[model samples]
Structure formats: C-alpha cells, structure tokens
Target: MDLYRNIPRKDKLLSLFNDDYAKTILNYAIDQELSNLRKLIADNKIHKIDEQLLIKNIDKRYNELISGSLKRVVNATGIVLHTNLGRAPLSEDFIHNIKDIVSRYSNLEYDLEKGVRGERYHHVVEYLKIITNCEDALVVNNNAAAVFLINNTFNKGKKVIISRGELVEIGGSFRIPEVIANSGAILKEVGTTNKTKISDYENAIDEDTTMIIKIHKSNYAIIGFTDEVPYREIPKIAQKFGLLSYCDLGSGSIIPGIGCNEPTLSEIYNYGYDLVSCSGDKLFGSVQAGIIIGKKKLIEKLKKNQLLRMLRVDKITLSLLQETLKAYLTDSYNNIRSVNLLGTPLTDLLKKAKKLKRILNRHLSDYFDFETKEITSYTGGGSCPMHEIKSYAVICKSKKIDINKIENFLRKYHIPVIIRLVDNKIVLDVRTIFEDEFVLIKDALVWATNQLS
Candidate 1:
C-alpha cells in the first residue's frame, strides 16, 4: 500500500515499541508525516517518496526522543538548595535506605506486634514525637498538605487569624490564603503587613475563631520598624478565646545559628503553639514531605480524620523521613547534606575552593583565566531567604569562547555543573559543590577547553 511504503526500514524503531505502544507513537508520527507528505505532494515528489519509509523515519526520531529520565539543564547559579536541582541532594546513607525500602517488601503497614495491619505514618510518628517533644505527630506529602490537613481537622468552618505580613506566596504561587481557602478555613487578617501586634488578634477574636494561626515568614524577613507577636504571647491569646493556636512553620529550621530567629519545632511547641507544621525537605533536609507535630489530643483528632489517610505519605517517604529524623536525633548534622553545607565554615570553604582552582588550573591554565574570589552563597529553596553566607568561587575566564555557549554546553553535559558568572567570567562556587564533585568540575573545565580550542 502507498501508506505502507511511507514506513521507514528502521529495525531499532520497529523493535522498541511493539504493535500496541507503536500504534500510539504512530498516530503522532503519522501526523508529523502528514505535514511532510503534504510538502512531497506539493513538490510533485509524492511518487518518489516511499510512504512506509516516511513513517519509519518519523518513528525512529520519535523513539529516540522518548526516554524515562526527566533530563534537563541545571544552571546551579549559586543557589545552594536550588529547588530545580531536586532541592537538597539526598545523603549517601539516606539514598541507600531509600533503595532498600523501595526495592523490597517493607513493614510499611504490617505491625509485627500482632501480625496485623499497621499504619504507614507510624514510621516517622514516634521519631517526630520524641525529637520535637510533641505528644503526637503526623506527616504528609509536603508542607502545604500538612497545613491543609491541620486546618481541615481543627479549623474547618472557622476563622484562622494570621498576620498580613506572614501571608506569603510560596514557590509556584501556592499562596497562604489559597491554601487556607482550600482547607475550608477562613483567613482572617489580624494586623498590618509589616507591623502586627497582640491587640490585633485580641480585637479580631470572635466565637467563630476556631484557631489563631501564626504563619512563619520563613522564606523571607520583614525588617525595620517592624513589630510582631511572639509565640510566648500567642498561647495566652488562644487560651483566652479557647482557640487552638497552630503555627505553619514553612521551611522550619532545626539547626540553630546564622541569625535567623526562627524557632525549631520543639521551641515553637515549648513556647506554646498547640500544633505546628513544617517541611521535611527545606530545613530538615529530607525528602519532600510535610511534618505536623503538636499536642496529642489535637494530633489524635487529626489522625482520626479521613482526609489524613488520603494525604498520608507512602512507604518510601515514611522510611526516608524516619531515618532522616534519626540523624537529627543523634546530632549527626552531617547526615543531612543541606544542613552540613550551611554549617561549613568560611575558612574551610575558601581552602576547598583554592584546592579546586589549583586542580582545574593544572589542566586549563593555558586556555582560561583562573582566579579564586570571595563570594556569598545562599541557603536557597526558600529556607534562609534573607541570609547570605560568605563563600569562595574559582572564577574562570574562557579565552575566545562564548561565555553563554560554554555555559550551555556545560549544563547539557551529563551530571551538569551549575556555575555563576562574575564580571562576564564563568565562576564555580565550591560552597554548594561537595569535595567529591571537585574532580567532576575539573573534568568539565578540561572538556570546555577542548570545545573552545
């Protein structure tokens, strides 16, 4: 048939997707072929072009493009927890545990006590309760989910009072108001954007006020002539109205230091937030999950909520979070890659950058200008939005090579290296890049030199 003639003689494409799968590919392939066929008809080359050959060629191209890996260029760009680069890199130990749990039959919901069905969240529940010193705890897929679960459980059909300044729009336009609305909680603005006081909440109090929520401005800071309420003062206010005080500590930090006055989960609970929700990924440096920790009475109510089971984390998340919490409990801060990077000293980072520069210069000395300079690295992924840590970078100037082109090529390479540009020169910040990635950077520089010359 004329249509059969358009199929190309490519065995690779033929074998890759068999009849059923190939049929799906063929529809789009044929649509693409239709455009080419139209051109052939217009050029009077319809008879010269084999119809089957055309289909096969298009299918070959389609097959080549369809792969499982979600490959994309990462211009690390000096953002430490670059959210696009999968936020924090999973620690080696965490990665191993993930593989072991995911690959086999885990005790995700199988209770060994009576050989009965178990709860998936039980994996991290005890750890969170112990570490945070909370009476009970729960976890979900992400912080947003945790917030929703808490609100739906406690504050539904009631008012959730929050400072206007604290109502932030998280990454991807996930605004605080929107989340509260979705959770069936009415967002009652308490005070001015930058200056909210205790009186604001006191005046806004009403019978419908089910909870007084304090949303931590974790990602950013409101400074200069700013007056805010503290956790210590909040419990009294909530107690006055018999309202549950919940704190959504987005990007909650466990490790202290670096000037952010944000309290840890334990601190918040101690200071008197009845319930607190934080992210597992951001400051905790674990997988993408939401951790809700608070009083047992409230948590037990949340646990009994049907929506809790719907938004509960899977076995893999449970396992990774459980192990990640253990690392926190043991004070093995190094086990969490993001926390470790944040805690590294400026002197140590400069020394490492100097070492990386020396290794790279040994290979590309003649090709590029190499110099180590002091820079500031961010605790990105919306963790420490306003804080900047002093860091060092090996700034390289490529001779006659297009800076953008060089950057594009480097980004396209396997296991891409993210670099920054200073004064039109390519700069690699060693703060975010670990010691092991140093050799990889050196190799990439060598490859870039080859591309230039």
Candidate 2:
C-alpha cells in the first residue's frame, strides 16, 4: 500500500509520453498505463515496480500507441476471401501497375487528348464494357453506395418492388430495406421469404412503381422448398410494364464457375436487365468498389446524379479495378489470387495438405502430431455461404501446448498464422496457402514449439 501510494504523480507519469507517440495519445495513454502499474503495486503481488520498470513500461506504452492498428497476417484458416485479412489478395500485375500510380501524379481527372477535364471512371469504363458487354458502366466507393445511388436516383419517392427472400443484410449489417428506405425509395416487398413470384412483382407494380430489384442472396442460403423468380424473369416483367429492372449480383462474379456461381455480368446484361451492380472486391478480386453496368442512357443518368460525385471512386481504386478487368480481358485471370485459389483442384488441395503435414512433421516431430484431415473450405466474403469447396487441411495436436496456446503462439510470430479450431483441433487449410507461404508456416511452427522441443 505504501509502495502504490508513493508512486509518482500523474504529471510525472504524463511526462513520460515522449516525441515517439502522437500528442493526443500522450496524456490518456500514460495515465491508463501508470494507473495499471499502480494497481499492480497496490495488489502487492507484482512486488514493487521500480522507477526503471515504470520507465520501461512507459516505453512499451509508447510503442503500443505508435504501432499500426492493422496487422498483416497469414490466412491459414482456409477461408480464401477472409474478410478480416483484407478480402482478396491483389495479383502481382495489379501491384506492379499500381506502383506508378501511387508514386506519381496521374491524369485522374484530366483528358490527355482533349486537354480538358476528364472522368476518372474512363479508366475502367472501356474495360467494363468490353468484359461485361454492357452499354456503359459506372463505379462508386462500395456496393452499398452503388445501390444507394441507383435507388436514390430513380426510385426515390417512388415504389421499388423486391422479393422478400432477397432482402439480405451483408457482413456489416447493411440491409437492403434500410438502404432503400434511406435513399428515399419505397420498398414494396412481395410474397413470402421462401417464394416470390413474377406475378407477385407484377401485382405490386402501378404508376408509383419505378424499378424492380432482384437481390441475389450471396452470403446465405435457405434450402428445402424454396421457390423464387429468376433474375431474368423479374426484369422481363419489368420491361413489360415499362419499369426499370436491376439485379444486385452481390458476389459480382465475372468467371462463371469460379466464385459463388452467381450469374456473370454478361449473363445478367444479356438477360435484359436495365441496371446491374456488383462488388469489385468480392468476386472480381480487386480492391473494394461497386461496379454498375447497364444501358447507356441509365448510366448517363447515374453519372449526372449529384450523388455520383459524392460516391465516386478515387484514382487508386480506378487504377486497380481497371487493371483487374484488363487481366480478365487478356484471359490472365488465373494470375489473380482469388481466382487461382478458387480454381484450385481438390487433388491439389489434398497434396498441399499432405505436404504441409509432412513439413510440420519434419520440423516439429517431437512436440506435435501432424495429420491430414478432410475439410471443406468456404468461399468467404459473403459471396457463397452455401457453396463450399471440399478440401483437406493439416491438423496439429501439440504435446505441450493447449489448443488456444497453439493459436496464440502462431500469433506471436512476426507474420501470424491465423488458424481455425475445428473439432477441438487446430486446422491449417492450404487452399489459400500458396507454395511460397508454406515455408513461413513451417518456420512459425518451429519457433512456436521450440520451447517444448
């Protein structure tokens, strides 16, 4: 008690916040840290934290304040589109191309030929047209922004009929009805959660009806006795009534079978949708952006919307999305991390699991048990929740470390290995684990188990 009472004043503690840390964090961080140290002394179990220990603790606090809030971690969890690990990994080409854009000032809004103000979306529009076969294209900050802009543009103060089954909220609690309502659009949900027919949509239509929306349930699935109108059918009925039809292809799949198995943009456009929107990051394997493809007149209308200016994608997003589309046009999509990973064969995944198991055995034979187990890897990022890629994983059972400790040990590495605890065992799925990252996993295992060995 005397030791804790004799502790330095709060001002003395605040003084320890040096130039290494931001000015804002100095006082609060120092007070919190010193308060903890004092509590330890008050408890008397920690003995007495000497002046040297206090100084050292404050330095640690400084490091914590300055450290980046985000970390680069290895995805051993088998969720390829792991949302937390920054979703899709960029291809080497995108990275290489982005260097020049990041390093130098770009003609982001400058027309080189016209010597005048140009649209930033021009960088990606031509490629989007080529790939999607749409009359025109537009991009915005995110899919929500795209949806908000679309609904707000045409359907505000008007009725937009949508299926009850398709009223989905993605990862961030961004709900369809909420977005529609916020855009000042009236949402007229028809039919039941499991069955919504084209007739139901047709019945909802009147003078107030401006657009019919089909939201593809990307993140979840409701199986058994579920019947809903096809995306083509809704748009067909909309066209009959002279109403606009839009499809929110949530996964934004470009490749037919690669991601989520959602219909491609070309398929949607060719099916006669007036407007279709999708995500650039989810299935496109690029940075986060929303791509809208449809009739030229509709896109031009979107461009003219005042909301377009507020929701426009920046130069970096344009450059990355443009390069990603180019890769698709050139048939170099296999070079993309997400595409290649999703396209990996089950046989290849099994081989990777076995190889990783063998490597772990060789390095950590004494302290752990390494075995290959049959597992199913998820096509994550709210793309295809029901669709799974059956694969194999390496399960590690440590002789000394508990299951949670094993995970913590991996996290202690310079590049942490994020694993999954399945059936009371730690699993490392090699589906997203490329050939190069294997060695790092091995090294992490060795370092983590060194004490036990």
Candidate 3:
C-alpha cells in the first residue's frame, strides 16, 4: 500500500506553516504527527491518507504545539477562589503597580536608604508587620512550604503534637502527618477524630515533645457533637510545658467583614501562639505564598535556617504581596479582586444576572430560553467549606440544542467560558464574571448556538 508514501515529508509539512512559529517547534510537531500516523498504519487503524488532509492535520498540530496550555478563561462557575483556575485573581491595579519593578531593575535586595546589601523579605515584611501587627513576618513559596519549614526548623528530630481531628489532608493529597514526618519531625496524634481536649495535648507531651501544632480544618468541617480545645488554649498549654506553639490557619483570613467563620489574622495573633502561618492566596486574596508571622526571635530563627533560601519567594511575589498589603493598610478592600468578588452584594449580582439574561434572550432566544435564577456560590480553594454565598445566575434551556453541546462549545471557545449545569440547564453565575467579560460571554454563547445549528 502507498499509505506510507501518502504521508508528506517533514520538509514539505514545514513549508505549510509560514507563520512566526519557531522552526524547531514546527519540526517537532511534524515529527510527532508523522510518528502517530505511522503507528496507526502499522496497527491497521488507518487504511488510507489524503495528502491535503495530512497537511491540514500537520498545520493543526503546529498551531497546537506553539499555543501554550495556560490561558485566560472566564470564570462563570461562581467559585471565587477557584484553585484549579489559578487560586486567586490578582487585581489589575496591583499588577500594574508592580509592572515597573518586575520589568526593570530595582532594589530587590538592596536597601536604597543604607546604600548596601539588604534582604528581599524586608520589602514586604514592614508592610505585613503594619497590617498584621505581628512582631515579624516571613513569606515562602506556598502555605505547605511554610508549614514544612516551620516543622523542620523548630521540631526536627522531636515530637510535635496535633489533634487527630485537625490532621487535615489539603488539596493534591498533601496530608498533615506526611508533611510533618517528612520534615524530620515525629507526629504525635492526640484525642479522637471528633474530639480533642486541652488535656489530650498536655498528656501527649513528654521529654521528646518540642511543639504543639494547631491545624485549621479549612477545607472541610466536622460538625455536631464535636469537642475541641480552643486555639487560644493550645498556646497556653505549650507555654506551661516550655514548648513552642504554632497555628497553621490554612486559609488565613486577613480582611475583616468578609463574613466567614474563619478567625482573622489579628485574632490569631492575639491567641498567644509563638508563630502563625496561613496561605496568601486563600482568603488573604494575594498571590500564592506561605505567610508566617510570629515572635521576632522565632522568625529570626526561621530566617537563619538553610531551607529558607530554597523556600524564599521571588521579587515578583514580594512586589505583588506588598501591593496587596498596601491595599489592606489603606482600607481599600475593593481594590483586591477576590475580596471585591466575595463582598459583592446579592442585589448587585441579581441586577447583573438580569441584565445578562436580557442580553442572552435578545441574541439566543431563537435557540434557547434565558432566565435569571438564584444560586449559591462558594469561596472555593479549600476555605469555608460550609459557607454558602447567595448569588444569581443566568439559566439557559434549549428545546433543539443539547445543553452539554453548548457547554462543550463554550468551554472550547477561544476565550473559554466556564459554566455549571443545574437541573440539566446551563447556568452562568454573574458573581465571578466581570462586567468587561459580558461581551465575551455573549460572543461565546452566540458562537455556541452557531455551531449547534
């Protein structure tokens, strides 16, 4: 069979892609496509190959190779702090403010006032101290790194006590016990899964005990008939035993009046713990960082640890976090995108939903019926598992087209519009959708209708 001959040469395929795509990538794409075609031929999966169709496939492969996987997508799912879609959305203003620092050279580690070498963490530490009112603060790559660094630094080769109920498994199968054990610390589980009293922690302490860690169950809740020692008590017990007390407030809340059950950073600070750690991306509404704020002496010890060099954040993270803290210091919560989205009033969301419904009706009415419906949103990213945010969504139903088809089309659009399905109807929550995205949403819906027709 001339099926193999029908497959064009790599050089021939390269000529088809005359765009700005890299030559190496184009060649790699051609090789991959040719290899797949050969395998199909050997397996008898393909009987014949059309030369023109082969060119088209090769062109498609080249474009796919050059186009990166990370893309900007519209979040219509109503989950504000969506972990999969890049945890927290940084404010445009924050990004704009840091453009100069990231794009050009600046005193990232140099102190201009002293005209000498300085520390990178200092840039944000002052801001954090001002906002959090902690004696000292440190920022790591992520919250997990912060926890591991703390454990490795303070409790290495020693026993660390934590309640069995508080041994949480965060996203991506990262468990608390595993992190502790891997950090050269022995994890001592205390009390039952549903209840752990202050006495449990005290009893667990022995000659090997070095610290008591209080892990916040940020992702899930164990409700009803539960008895747990107050967080403030853990610090007291540790002090009596001459041990360190640290709290991992997984999704650390810095902003007040957000209406979540999680305690704020200030309240946690006043809990008398030697150190406190929380995620910068979660309720903090900043970039992905591990924030450790505590006694100056303890923080100084963490800074001296060799692991600090590895887990330290880059200048970009420091700048972004600095701007976010500045927003907090100025009491401009609205400037933070995540906080703004979380604080959006129900009536405002309803108005936006109604406006979207009318827009969809005017354009897609012939194919689908559009109406506004009340729905519940979430502060996703493993924070406030039991809290439900009342929101509004635009529900679409079609008599001719399949709901799944519309969803698939919108998801694959150039600017993907992520949506949810409720009662077999396509729903788009306006809480997470921005006003500037309205045009994009309408265009995606219209494109979906065209494809379905």
| Best of the candidates, TM-score | 3
Name the TM-score of candidate 3: 0.97
Clash number for model 3?
0
Candidate 3 per-residue C-alpha lDDT over 1-453 given as tens digits, one digit per residue, 9 for 90 to 100: 768887777777777777687888778877887898899999999898867777777778877776776899999999999998998899989988999999999898898999999999888889878877899999999999999999999999999999999999988999999999999999999999999998898888999999999998978888898999888898999999999999999888887667377888878888898999999998999999999999999999999999999999998999999999999889888888898899999999999998888887888888888888898878999888889989999988886888899899998899899999988898899999998898899999999989989
The global C-alpha lDDT for each of the candidates, from Candidate 1 onward, is 0.78, 0.85, 0.89
Poorest 10 consecutive residues by lDDT, candidate 1: 67-76
How many residue pairs clash in all the candidates, one count each?
A: 14, 0, 0
Colliding pairs, model 2 = none
Between prediction 1 and prediction 3, the one with superior lDDT is 3
lDDT of 3: 0.89
For each candidate, give its TM-score against the true structure. Answer: 0.86, 0.92, 0.97
TM-score for model 1? 0.86
TM-score of 2: 0.92
lDDT of 1 by residue, 1-453 (tens): 364355444454445555655566665665676677767766766566564576567766566456425664333355657777777666888878689779988888899998999877778888887777888888888988988888888788889899888999887888989988999989899799889999999999888888888887767888898999987788889988888888887777776663245577788888878898888887778888888888888888988989977788888888788778899899888888878877778799889879988898888787788888888767778777788777788888877777887876687556677777768899887777777777887787678657766
